[model samples]
Every structure is written in structure tokens, then in C-alpha cells.
Target chain A: MTADHLESRRREIVLAALRCFAREGFHATSVRDVVRESGLSAGAVYSYFPSKAELVAGAVAPILEALTGVLDAVVLDGVRSVGEDRTPTEAVAEVLRRIYPIAVGGEVDYTRVAVTAWAEGLRDPAVRAIAERTYGTVRGRLTDRVTRWRDAGHLPADVDAGALGQVLLSTLLGFVLQHALLGDVDLDRYATAVALLLPRG
Target chain B: MTADHLESRRREIVLAALRCFAREGFHATSVRDVVRESGLSAGAVYSYFPSKAELVAGAVAPILEALTGVLDAVVLDGVRSVGEDRTPTEAVAEVLRRIYPIAVGGEVDYTRVAVTAWAEGLRDPAVRAIAERTYGTVRGRLTDRVTRWRDAGHLPADVDAGALGQVLLSTLLGFVLQHALLGDVDLDRYATAVALLLPRG
Candidate 1:
């Protein structure tokens, strides 16, 4: 197969594996299941991913990319839209509103997969690296934005950028936990509560 | 066996299982491991718990009780201490400070077990019931306290009690997630960020 064809084939297998993991869970879904779901031979699946951990990492790559994309857009928009009379709180709230639907929306079950990955990360170093990298990337993006907001006088000088970023990220994480564990939440009310965390001008 | 003797034996087995789950993992640890850890025969282990799911529920029971006890204390203190000139925010912060050490401390690893339980809850209905009931109890207690605060003029009248409770719980949940994922957080900074979440008096 050509390089592009190989890459496409890998993507196809990873997507199939993700569906199985979401449906049957990481521990319950075996390589055979992935092969069955992908309609590919056992040899083909093994060639692409020798183990379930590698398959999980492959499946998770797209989610990390999508999450980082959302963070980048939100941070950039927060910076660019300041002149349009938008508050940082509004910007953060907008990010939550936009991301909430995708994180908890129908058919995809991203939260379940992410939660499973988190649990797996505790015992699996490979999965831990992926979880840590994703968290670090999100925290770094938030830290940068928070620093900018402080320097630009949008937030208080005493605001610890790292802590603020964590606080914000925690809100998002907390939202995911609540959604996954308890069912739907009132996003508007959640957004308002989050806004209360912002420094008032 | 006497009822008291049977109760103690059950506790011993559950503790052994908890250790295994904490050290290994829920999915990785099996009934055999629990039996080995507890130094009991397979028949004895089976007599006490029919399945791993039952063992998980048994293991999680104490943690839930401890959590609810903490919440009850915090909410009661938040109410009783109001007359002593402490703000509700201060009461909440105090709770975080007291709980932070225990939640993130070494050896016990409540966060890891909780995260594992959460992941298990996704695939197991019995575990899911335990997780949901614990969450509901905590949220309900928090909602009651928030309502009391608002009614007493400590908080704004318009604050949604349920949302505020959820936001606060999310902060705690977020702290747990961060601690479990990243190891240690600046609890002081986290406490300060949490204080900022409360309405300014």
C-alpha cells in the first residue's frame, strides 16, 4: 500500500476500535472484536496495533486534537474579541457552551471513552502519557490566555495564571464528570456560576 | 458464625479487596487476588460476595459514608458558624482545606479508588447505582445548604441553589481529578480560587 493508503487504513481501524471501546469498554473489548468491527483480518489489525494500549492511544489521538483545536479557537477568540466589549468571563462561558454539546452529545459517548482512558491511565504508563499530555496542553493554553488577560489588565494582577487555568479546566472537567455520572445539567446556570468566578471590573 | 464474627470477616475481605483495587486496579484485580490478599479460601470469598461487582459495592460503601460525613460536617458548620461571623465562602474554604489533605494524601488513595469506581460505574449497573446515590446525596446536602445561605441573606437571592451546589461540588470533583491525574496541586491556590467563586459580600 502507498503511504497515504496505509494512513487511511490505520484511521479506519482506529475508528472501528473506538466504536467498540465506547460500546463495550476498554477492558471488555478485545482485539478480535476490533477486527470484527473493522471487517479486517486479525493479521491486519495486529500489524497496525500490536496491543490494545496502542490501539487506545491511536483512537485517542483524534480526540486530543479536537480538544486542543477547541481550546485554541476559544483562546484566540478571547484575545481577538476583547476589543468588541466582550468580557473574559463571557469568553470562557462561550467556550463551555460550545464544548458542552459536543462532549455530552448523543451517539458519540466521548465522555465515557475519556473517563475510561483516565482510569486506564492510572495503571498504564502509555495511557498515562496520553492523558497527561492532553491535560498539559489544555493547561498550557489556558495559562497563556490567563497571562495575557492579566497583562492586559482584564484580570487582577494577583491572579495566579496556573491556578486560574486549573480552576477553569476543573470547571470543564467537573462538568464532564457530572454529565457522565449524573445526566444532563443546566448549561446556562452552569455558565452563570462560572462567570461568577471571574474578577469583576 | 455469630453475626458479629461474620461482619468482621466481611470487613476483612472488603479491605483486602480495596487494597488490591488500589494497588492493581478494578479490572486487573480478580476474585483470586482478593482471596489471596484476604488469606481466605475461594469458597469463603464466594460465600461473602457472589461477584466482583458486589465486592466493589462493598468496598465503596465506606468511602461513600466517609464522604457524606465530611459533607454533612461542612454543611452544618457552614450553617452554624454563620452566627459566629464566618462567611459561607470561608466555611466552604475551610471544608476544602480539611478535605484536601485527606483526599490527596499518600497511601490511602481515595481519588484513585473513586476514579476507578467511576469508570466501573460506566459498565456496571450496581456500581453505577452506588456512584449515583452517593453523588445525589452530596448534591442534595449542598443544595440545602446553598438554599439556607441564600435565604439567610448570606448569598444573593437570585443564585440557583442547585447550580451553585453543583459548581461547588464540581470544584471538589475537579480537585480530585487533578490530584489523581497530576499528583499534587497547590491546595492553597485551589482554595483561593474556590473562594473567588463565592459571591463577594
Candidate 2:
């Protein structure tokens, strides 16, 4: 097959897997589910992705990248330099804004997969590796931001940045869980409440 | 069978299901898994709990009651008369204190089950019904508290109680998720961060 044919086939497989993951969850779903969902033969599916782990990884990679991209846009790029007078809540508001669309507003619902990944991570070793890495990276970035905020005098000197960071990340993760499971979970209101918690400039 | 014997057998079946649910997940676990875990025949299991739904409900009712009890301890009973000087953070702290042992300290790790319930609720209609009621009730209580705080002048007049309540519930839910999955998540630090977020006395 041509290179374009191979790429298209791979995309088709990944999309099919995303659907199954979103509906049945990453761990509960099997390779056969992807095969059945794709309307492609098991052999054809296997030829592209070797196993269930690889299949889920393949399907989830883009969503992961997109989620990271959203975080990077807010946490990494949205932060102003020290003494520039940026409130932590402002960056947070941006993060939630960028997250809402990706979490539930797409052809593939990322948070739905995310909620499963968090749950399945407790029991599935393979899935746990992915979850731990992602969670660690996210938490580390938030911690660094919190430290930066404190250093810049946006927050008090005695504030525990690490603890604050964990709670901050938890709030976001909690929002994703609620939004994924409950159809009408509003982000704007949550964001407002979060802003109230942060120190105003 | 004697009443005591029948009750004991029912408890045995429910306990078996809880183990399976924690290991696999409520939506993913089969009644056969419960039977196998119980070391009892399928007939014996069915005689106690007619179906998977009823089985999970039986398994989770106590945990649910316990969770609500924690909430009630803080949100319901912990609240003092208007003009009584209990900070919102104090009530939150008490709730966290009560919740720690129940969520991760016990023989049955409830937050672990809770994480799965949130994920499984997305697709399992039967599970979804239970989840909706739980989340709806929790959010409603939090919202009511926010309104009470505002009305009592604990919070500002302009604060959006519904949104604040949602975020408040999210923070707690987020704490549960982290605690269940990460194994070393410090509720004390999280509680501290939560305390920082609430209005100071």
C-alpha cells in the first residue's frame, strides 16, 4: 500500500479505538471491540496496532497531546514574568476555558477517556504507567507555577506551593470527572469560585 | 433458613461484589466474579442478591451512607446558627478528617470504588442513575451551604452560590480521586490548601 494509504488506515484505526474507549472505557475495552467498531478484520487491525495496550496508546496519544497542549498554553505560556502583576486565577481561568472544549466538546470526548484512565489506573498496570506519568508531569508543572507565583509576590511567602499545586490540580481533575460523568457540569461557575479562592491583586 | 443466616449470607455476597468492583469496577464486574470471589455457588449468590444492580447497590449502600454522613457531619450538623463564628474552612477540615479513614483507611477502599463509579457512570445507565443521584445531592448540599454562607454574611453577597458549591464539591471529589489513585496523596496538605482558599475569619 502507498504511504498515504497506510497513514489513513492508521487514523481510521485510532478513531475507532477512541470511540470504544469513550463508550466502554480503556481497560474494559478489548482489541476485539476496536476491531468490531472499526468494521475491519482482526488481522487488519492487528497489522496496524500489535496489542490492546498499543491500540489504546495509539488512540489516546493525540488526545493526550492535545490536553498537554492546552496546559502548556495556559501554564507554560500564559504566565507573565515576575513583577508583571498576573494573578494565578487568571491563568487558571484560561486553563479552564481551553479545557472545556477539549474535555467534552469534540468528536472524541477526551475527559471521558481521562475519567476511565484515572479509575482503571488503580488496577491496570499498563494503564497506570500512562496515568502516573501524565499526572506527575501535570502536577509538577502546576507546582512550578505556584512556586513562581510565590517568588513573584503574587502569593504570600508562607503559602505552601506544593500543597497548593496539588489542590489546584485536584480541582481541575475533579472538574473533568464531574463534567465527564454529569452532562451539565458548568465550568464558568466553577472558575468563578476558584477565582474567589485565589488572592486578588 | 434462619434470619441471621440469611442476613449473613447476604452480607457475604455484597462483600464479594465490593472486592470485585474495587478490583475490576462496578460496570465491568460480573455476578459470576462476585460468586467466584465469595467462594459460593451462583445459585447461592443469586438467592441473596437477584441481579448485578441490586448486588452493587447492596454493597455500596453503607459506603454511600457513610460518605453522606461525613458530609452531613460538616454541612448539616457542623453549621452553627447565623452569626456563629465557624469558618467554612473549619467545617471543611472536619469533613476531611472524617473522610480520610473512610475513603482509604478501611478494609474496603471506598474512593477506589468511587473513582470507578464516576467513570462507569458515563456509559452504564443503571450505574449512571445512582451516580447522578449521588452527585446531584452532593452538589445541591454544597450549593445550599454556599447560599447559607452568603445569606449569613459568611461569604460576600455577590458570590454565585451554585458555582461555588459546584467547585467546592469538585475540590473534595478531586481530593478523593487523587487519594485513591496516587496512594501517597496527603489529605492534610490538601486540606491546608483548601483552607487557604476559603474566606478567612
Candidate 3:
């Protein structure tokens, strides 16, 4: 195959592997499983990814990149809207609403893998690095937003922006876990509760 | 084996399966692996728990029971202190302090399995029954505490006790996930943040 054709094939195998991994898990999944899921022969699959870890890494890196993009957009939106007519809580909640869908969409698998990696990564260095990078980017973006709000006096004077960001991230993760466990369509009620958790001036 | 010895051997197999499942996952682990971990013959292991599902159920039921016991202690402590001289926030924090270790203990494997079961239970009726029983009891306890606080005017009139309990539960789960990921040792910080989320009188 041409280089471009090979690259496309690699992406196909990666996506298929993620679906299998999500349904089962990284360790439980085999090369044969990915081959069957991708409708590719064993040789064709081997041509793209060398190992299962490589396949997981390939699938996860892009999803993590996309999630970071979403988080960055949220932070940028908050910053751009800071000087606008809206209150800081409103801006923060608006950013949150933008983020809630990503957690439940294709990123649902991402969240699953991320949580698994977090627990398993304690022993697996390669997985741990990927998990840490993803978490750091997420936490960093949140800390920046909280810091801005604190500077604008949108929070209590003694508020620790760093810790508050941790709180917000923790809350968001909890909501996502609930969604993962319960297939509910009405998140508006939960969203309102989350909005209340934001620091109100 | 004697009946009592047989029962003890079965418990050993289930606990070993739990460790194996936690270290790997439900799908990655096999009956052989569990037996290897338990130092029992594979046939001996299966004689007690007929299937992996049964083994999983045996392993997790006690963890759920323990979790409910912790919730009961929290609610009972809150009720006992209801007539005592303490702020609502302080009382809630006290209960949280009593319950935080369950999130990050040696039994964390059981917690992981519980989480996995909770998510999978969404689609499986049999598993869902177990998940619902586990969640309902915890939610009921939390609802009781939040209701008590609201009636005592420790919470604002605008607060929904059920929603507040859900939020608290969500926050606790999220914190556990974060700490599991980051190796955070400070439950006190998390409990304090949760206290801040509750409505003040």
C-alpha cells in the first residue's frame, strides 16, 4: 500500500481496537480481537500496529488531544467573555455546559480508559505517563480559569484557586461517572446543581 | 472437604479472583489465573463458584455491604448529633471524615469492581439489580442526612435534598477517582470542599 493508504489503515485499526478495548479492556483484548473487529486479516492488522500497547496509545492520544482542544476552547471562551456583560459564574457555567457533552460522547470511552489508566498506571509506567499528561492538561486549564475568577474578586478572598479547580474537576468527573452508570437524558437538573457549586460573587 | 472447609475455600477463591480482577480486569482474568493466585486447584475453585460472574458477585457483595455500613455510620452519627451543638457544615464534614477511607483502602480492588459492575449493570438486568440495591441504600442514607439538615434550617429553603445528596455522592466518587489517579492523601481537603458545596443556613 501507498504511505497515505497505510496511514489511513493504521487509523482504522486504532479506532477498531479502541472499540474492542472499551467493550472489554486493554489486557483482555488481543490482536485477533482487533483483527476481527476491523474486518482485517491478522497480517493486515500487524502491518499497522506492532503491539496492543501501541494500538491503545494510538487510539488514546488523538482522543486526549481532542479533549484538550475542547478544554482549551472552554478556557478561551471564559477569558474572552470575562470583560463582557456576563458575571464570572455565568461565564464559568457556560464553559461547563460546553464541556458536559464531550464527556458523554465518543469521549465516553476516553473517560473509561482514563479512569482505568489512573488506577492501573500506578504499576504501568507507559500508561501512567499518558494518563498524567491528559490529567495535567485538564487540571491546568481549570486552575487557570479559577485563578482568573479569583483575581476578579468573583470568589471569596481566601479561596485557593488551585484547590477550587481540583474541586470543579472532581465534580465534573463525578457527574460523568454517574452518567456512565445511569443512562439518563435529563442532566439539566444535575447541571443546575453543578452551576450552584461555582463560586458566586 | 468438610462443608465449612468448602465454604472457606470458596471464599478464598473469590477473594483471589477479586485481586486478579482488580490487577487485571474481569475480561483479562481467567479461572486458571484466579486459582493460581489462590493456590487452589482450578477444579476446586469452580466447585464453589460455578462461573466468573458468580465469583465476581461473591467478591463484591461484601464490599457493597461494607460501603452501606459506612453510610449507615455517617447517617447515624448525623442523627445522633442532630440535637447536639454543631453547625450543619461541621456535622456533614464529620460524617465525610468517617467515610473517606473506603475510597482509598486496600479494599480498593473491590471498589474498582463495584464501579465496573455499576457501569456494566446499566445494560444488564441481573447486574443492574445489584447495582441499584447498592446505590439505593447509599443514596437513601445521603438523602436522609440532607433532609435532616434541610428540616433543621441548616440548609437554605431553596435546596433540594435529593439533588444535594446526589451532588454529595457525585463529589465523593469524583474525589476518589482523582485520588486513585493522583495518589492524593488528603481526604480532609476534599471533605472541606464538599462542605463548601452544601448550602449554609
Residue B198 in model 2: shift from native, Å?
Answer: 2.4
lDDT of 1 at A120: 81
Order of candidate numbers by lDDT, starting with the best = 2, 1, 3
Q: For each candidate, report its DockQ versus the true two-chain complex.
A: 0.59, 0.66, 0.34
Q: Write the per-residue lDDT of candidate 2 for residues A1-201, one digit (tens) a residue.
A: 999999999999998998888888877789999999999999999999998878867877776787688878778763555566445656666778887776667778888888887877888777777777777878887788788888777667988888888878877887787778877767787787777767553
- The TM-score leader among the candidates is 2
Return the top candidate by DockQ. 2
1 or 3, greater by DockQ: 1
lDDT of 1 at B52: 94
**Weakest ten-residue segment in model 3 chain A by summed lDDT:** A83-92
> Which is the better candidate, 2 or 3, if ranked by DockQ?
2
Over B7-109, each residue of candidate 2 has an lDDT whose tens digit, in order, gives 8888888778888888888777989989899999999998878988788678878777877888887877635674674556556666777878876676688
Worst 10 residues of 1 chain A by lDDT: A81-90
Correct interface contacts retained, every candidate: 0.54, 0.65, 0.29
* Stretches > 4 Å off in candidate 1: A1-8, A80-89, A104-107, A151-156, A199-201, B1-7, B78-90, B104-107, B152-156
Which parts of model 2 are misplaced by more than 4 Å? A1-5, A78-80, A83-85, B1-5, B82-84
Sort by DockQ, best first: 2, 1, 3
> How does each model score on TM-score?
0.88, 0.91, 0.78
